[model samples]
Target: MQFKKYRPYERVENIQRDWPNNHITQAPIYCSVDLRDGNQALVNPLGIEQKLEYFNTLVKMGFKQIEVSYPSASETDFGFTRMLIEDNLVPDDVAIQILIPAKKEWIKRSVEAMQGVKNGIFHLYNPTNEFQRRVVFNKSDEEIMNMAVESMQYLVELTQEFQGNVTYQYSPESFSQTQLDFALTICNKVIDVVNPTTDKKMIINLPNTLEACTANVYADRIEWMSKRLNKREAVILSVHPHNDRGTSVASAELAVLAGAQKVEGTLFGNGERAGNLDVVNFAFNIYSQGVDPKLDLSMIDEVKAMYEKQTQLQVHPRHPFVGDMIFTAFSGGHQDAIKKGLDYYRKEHCQEWNVPYLPIDPKDIKRGYEKVIRVNSQSGKGGVAFIISEFLGEELSKEEAIAFGHMVKQKSDEVQRELSKEEIIALYQNSNRV
Candidate 1:
């Protein structure tokens, strides 16, 4: 009965859905929403100092656009926005963005916060979902449309007096749940009001505020709108995917294939409920495909450490690319294949990365190969031998390795746990009576 109460996601009817055949060969224009989206979800949100530190890290990572805060919502957010400007902490190349509701009082206050900003974005959002329209606001279609139009009109008027280069961005909150036609209409209408040119483009961010469908279906919706939206050439089409369905990464990848030019997400997928899209995970996905993601991820461990320190959130040990156990192999068959693959790679001097069980080299992200093999009762002889040879750097014949492997497995079994590298080495010395 609980399952029956939920309605199925309506499939987008498109015979020419090209995203399935398309591949993402390049990185999207990434906008990190870590401070706004990621920070809001944290149990202990970062203070100004922490936020500034995080912002600097994003800049160092080569993020061009970062949504810093919802300025009008709180005193702290407003102060942070001013500090970045008055303190001159923002770089000329980076554009610091602040979110604001489509309301005049908030917009006016947001404009005040953004004063003296060199390059900035005034992000406006309003819920456009059916439930919000019919029940929450109790407003008709025309009324809702007018609110967005008038807000854009007022926002433009307020920002015109400012000296900085300003870019406008709009998000139809809960965009994935809105009717495809209405979503397109609302976005196009906002574009018409802004009248963005090729030199100065407006961002239309379609957020999966509440993910309701499979990744492919979301791609179809994006493609459908991308094909039909007006002033398309002057608009930077973006997608902000939330990880409600545990498919935010897949959804973002498909959205890019479907014609999205920009992606708004947080590092490590930190956000409300499940989380936002993990930018590092998505970026490295491109890196794994032999494309440069443009972000400096070579020091991922350092970044992870900083993120954990600021947010007090521990990254899952099995998280892709930066995880502790991602490159590890405890299985005998896997260990054997990986060892063989690495050996072949070094022997053949291959240009392409084609190692078995490892996608990109761990060294590419500054991770060492020492932890790739660990010994336990479940591990095979090949794994134990691989660890001995790789970690201990002991030269052993196949026969000697097998003999040593048998000893390691028995010790691990006797201990009823994984054998540490030190313990394994000790076992090896005892086996040889060395």
Candidate 2:
């Protein structure tokens, strides 16, 4: 492989960036694109029943905006949209978003699918990156701008005759790769066509469709565009960052700090390639920082179970918040510190979470304290003592704990697996007899 063939992505220069100094004090508007972006990437896309169930789950979890599907692309997608509208499955507060390319026929088809919807966001997108323009479409800059403008104009015209509350959203697709000026210019033109009023706002989604650069660059670009965009009050600046560079969450957070008011993502970052930003991870990150994320993720395990079952995908054991092993401690030092911290927390009747290794208490997310410390060959005396106290309801003296920890380590090494609660208790009983 010729590793030297690739050049670094260009940097945004000559900007007085303020996102670095600013903090994300509040939650951004979250739009789950699981049914569209996440479904498209799945080996077996979600059936209508699964989609319906997932939609209901998302609503229950406090999502007000959901990009349900690209209705023009498939019969299933179109049918799902129709079912939601006809069955009155969509809630009054939730806005269902539909993704369609910025083309005449597709726009018409998307609009047709959204007929009778109470609240809908007609999301239009077209790739405007330099490579896509020069090589793929062979269109000039003016031609690209005209495509977005014409489509926005047509959508505005169609919505006038439509019988629903319609919201408009435009994405300069691959905004991360596109020149920042062109991205801003195209969004501004689309805004002009939409002519949004103060009461109603249009969404301009700047997506890192390929996630080409570092997160800081994306934040810089978002801030730069936000500062220059026309009719700022009448527009909702949104971001949809992919995890190609494994920093989608960081990019989204930084973007929010920079000026993005909304974020579009999937539940577990399930999308093409590395995936979209994990909304669960993002929300919980805020929750840990003492902010209300506005999403009801308290029963995260149930959500993970449903997502895994429907998507036929496993959440990685180390996945930020919802993964199986995220709260588990197997390392000796970590276990010891966690045990001390947890003990201090309980003894002090602390109101704020200040455990050493555990960020937010496992109990906060309905995860019990059972697996927080597990005994293994690497387990320390503190961990063994914790396990005994947790599972067997017995307190051990310091010397007894030290001796028992050695015996547990030897047994674990001999068995070449972690010991169970019963086995640890049996060992404790046997040692007492001796």
RMSD, every candidate, angstroms:
1.3, 1.1
lDDT of 2 by residue, 1-434 (tens): 99799989898899999999998889999999999999999999999999999998999999999999999999999999999999999999999999989899999999999999999999999999999999999999999999999999998888897777889999999888899888989999999998888898899999999998899998999999999999999999999999999999999999999999999999989999999999999999999999999998887888888999999999999988888888998888998889889888999999999998888899878889988888889887888888888877778888888888899999999999998767888888888722
Give residue 298's error in model 2 in angstroms.
1.2
Best by TM-score: 2
Give the per-residue lDDT digits (tens) of candidate 1, residues 131-208. 899999999988888888889989998888778899999988889889988888888889899999999999999999
TM-score for candidate 1: 0.98
| Candidate lDDT values, in order | 0.89, 0.92
Model 2 clash pairs are: none
The count of backbone overlaps in candidate 2 is 0
- In model 1, the worst 10-residue window by lDDT is 425-434
Model 1 error, position 146 (Å): 0.4
